[model samples]
Target: MGIQTIPGYMTRGIVVNGHGQRFINEDVYPGLVGIEALYRQGMDVWVVLDEEAFEDVPEAERWGLQPPHVAETVAELEKGMGLPEGAAVGGDGAAVFTLGGLATDDEGRVRDRDGGPIAGPYAAGRASSGLHGGGYISGTSLGPGTCFGRRAGCAAAGAQQ
Candidate 1:
């Protein structure tokens, strides 16, 4: 999903699998969360938040998912949600895009192992690692992709000339 859902996971809570088992550290970037959710939990995940944590989330940030199930305690919440006795929390990941890409130069030329640009070929967007590294922030992809895509086109054309 978009950055709007950041507040949901970045809450004063923990993320767990269907079995009420904690998985990834909730403090990491959202991209890391998505990776962990996809690979480890297979997207079967939940965000366990106490009342204060739940209240802190604004309605707009909920991302139009079904309303949260509230209860007097974690066990009750878990029961109501049909999770294992202790699994008391959650969210559905909308999308998990690739994080890193091929190494490239400023002009969008692909880099060789020697750290020099390869001739004739150029790359950009998610196809080239222009700015992103281990973590991801929503909205960071589009701008870099657009900017570097243009740079790559220019560089490719210049190389042909």
Candidate 2:
């Protein structure tokens, strides 16, 4: 799962001397502002994917996370999703540019202009889900398929006690 623009959006950047660290920062975003700020701290992000539109939108009206920066558009975002640039395949038909914006109509059910997932849309995480023996690593979230057999076994053992 990627980070969204809520209060505690998960981030992974370096802590430099003058950079904000959430609590002490006075700006809306406490960490690096953008790629420049991140690079200024001698750190490079593999992919800068974070949910935007993190405003006062209601939970039901909200689709998914918005793209924080204007430059972090769909075209510049697919590299983070393991897709080729201007990919013309699933999601948006045969000609999709970016996979990172929320292009919705009055109904809020269309792919974003950049071909990214719209708000409230359910999208598969861009990462691979295959483990050595179906175990979670660092980045995987606790989804449904992640752990069942082991949990059921543990539950059965506990019930016996």
Candidate 3:
């Protein structure tokens, strides 16, 4: 299971890799952060925040984790975390789902490379690419998933009958 971090925590901090190099911009959606972290830093990533940034997070959004490690300096924090001398820091980011999927028609039929619907194998929801293009907005999949999933189901049912 993955621990979900709140947007407030993500946007207010800088994400660094094991080498203490800053990567993605912290202002975008947290999903994008997860993707970039996985691609650029593998699993060795951390979000570094200042005192104000840490305090800005509401207690409820902390996911019941213990208080963050306090340190007088970045080197001190890195030493405590067992990282290299310059490495910066937490919240392990795990991608919940990918953004893109199989191309599908309105009826949820899978689309071929030539842009025609395949004969069988209808896909919907996260299984097929629908609303998302490049970036993701939280909860954006729910509406399209329901509508397209129903269309796919109805189409499949009609074909069966």
Candidate 4:
């Protein structure tokens, strides 16, 4: 099996690390950036979504997933999650730690920091990085792979000529 990058997820809630403190803005950067922040604090992190946020989740999305553990107020969720007293709680969110993969350009061509595409190689799926700018929304993982994979395939075919 390959290493997996478990991204943090939250539709609506406050995210706090094990120390009962927030490290990143939940609304601003909810993707890898937020996950990176949680990693700095410690392995243990929790996203406490209130009832309102839970209700916002679309029915289709909730199909297979188990119901979330919820509380009436942020304070209550914090208590259940073992966060420190008076920990600042914010909006809906959650995070999971996962392995980072290769950086790629818009065309699905692997590239260096300087933006030069690497020769004879491409990457898509979880290994690609060009699709999501900041926060990766739910239901985006497969879409990017399918879209960029097509581009990468075309680019590869052209390069062989």
Candidate 5:
């Protein structure tokens, strides 16, 4: 069963795949991204948090959550989580997911493989591939989108003129 967790659940700890090794950034998109990593490792992963990081989490945020498998140190956390000894883990399945989007021009116009802009249809924000060609940057999921969305909208509006 999946747990509704606060973002802090990720920012504070490290995440490891089924093999108990760090794969992607702990704070990556936080959903499909992390899940994909899990699939890559072995489809079963764990989050190991040290007592200090666990305690640092706010009580309110932990609301309605299962008590974390407690451990005083990393080794214990790994053992508790059934990971290999000394395995570093956290946010087992929280990294956000990102996929390559429709290729777009600077004006947010979708382009074909031949680099020709597709007529009429346009994309912006995460829907457009320009901002994040292969990967994404944290905290940028929205800003560029808003800006590009506006540009696309304006361009679309003018094209209708």
Candidate 6:
């Protein structure tokens, strides 16, 4: 829908012509959601990913370089990941592609270095309950303030409870 220029490259696009064989891109923004809908309509995808697209996101949330064929192999999982009667792995098997995932628990909840809760779901500076940081542990290198923040909140909550 718009064009943006990064330091190195510029992505310029426009509504050239809308009609297609049977499918349309629907949205011009690279960050638009529901990619499978386009797939369902027989449109093969060509994602041109780069750093600026993921700049604001936490490092853990980014996918570095999954093989190009990974999406092809995982195609069955895209449409709900469930099988008709045989059961399947697409619908609920650690599924990892959705729009709201950035704000939701897809990247896992943040917990403290101890077995305590930290900031809820910041992309950074807080510990994680499920996801691992660049360090060797599930919770490390994050700002300790987040852990104490939860502690104080928990104390207040306990007093009220």
lDDT of 6 by residue, 77-105 (tens): 23322213233222322223211212212
lDDT of 2 at 91: 40
Clashing pairs in 3: none
Judging by lDDT against the true structure, name the best candidate. 3
Q: Which ten residues in a row have the lowest lDDT in candidate 2?
A: 15-24
TM-score of each: 0.46, 0.17, 0.48, 0.41, 0.47, 0.19
Query: What local distance difference test score does each model get?
Result: 0.66, 0.33, 0.69, 0.59, 0.62, 0.31
Looking at model 6, which ten-residue stretch has the lowest summed lDDT? 13-22
* Model 3, span 38-145: residue lDDT tens: 665775666667788878788887766443457788788787655677443344343345544578888989999788988989998767753443466678889878
Any residue pairs clashing in model 2, and if so which?
52-66, 63-119, 63-120, 64-119, 64-120, 74-98, 75-98, 103-112
Candidate 2 backbone clash number: 8
lDDT by residue (tens digit), candidate 4, 41-135: 54566665555666676656655454344666767766776767676644433343322256787777888857899887799876764335555
Candidate 3 segments exceeding 4 Å error: 1-4, 87-161
lDDT of 1 by residue, 1-161 (tens): 11123546454677666666666656555667766677767777776667777666676776664335678876787886568864433553333344444679899988996899887678888777534445566777798889889988998888888
TM value for model 3: 0.48
Of models 2 and 5, which has the larger TM-score? Answer: 5
- Evaluated against the true structure, the overall lDDT of model 2 is 0.33
lDDT of 5: 0.62
Ranking by lDDT: 3, 1, 5, 4, 2, 6
Clashing pairs in 6: 80-91, 81-90, 81-91
Q: How many backbone collisions does model 6 have?
A: 3
lDDT of 1 at 33: 72
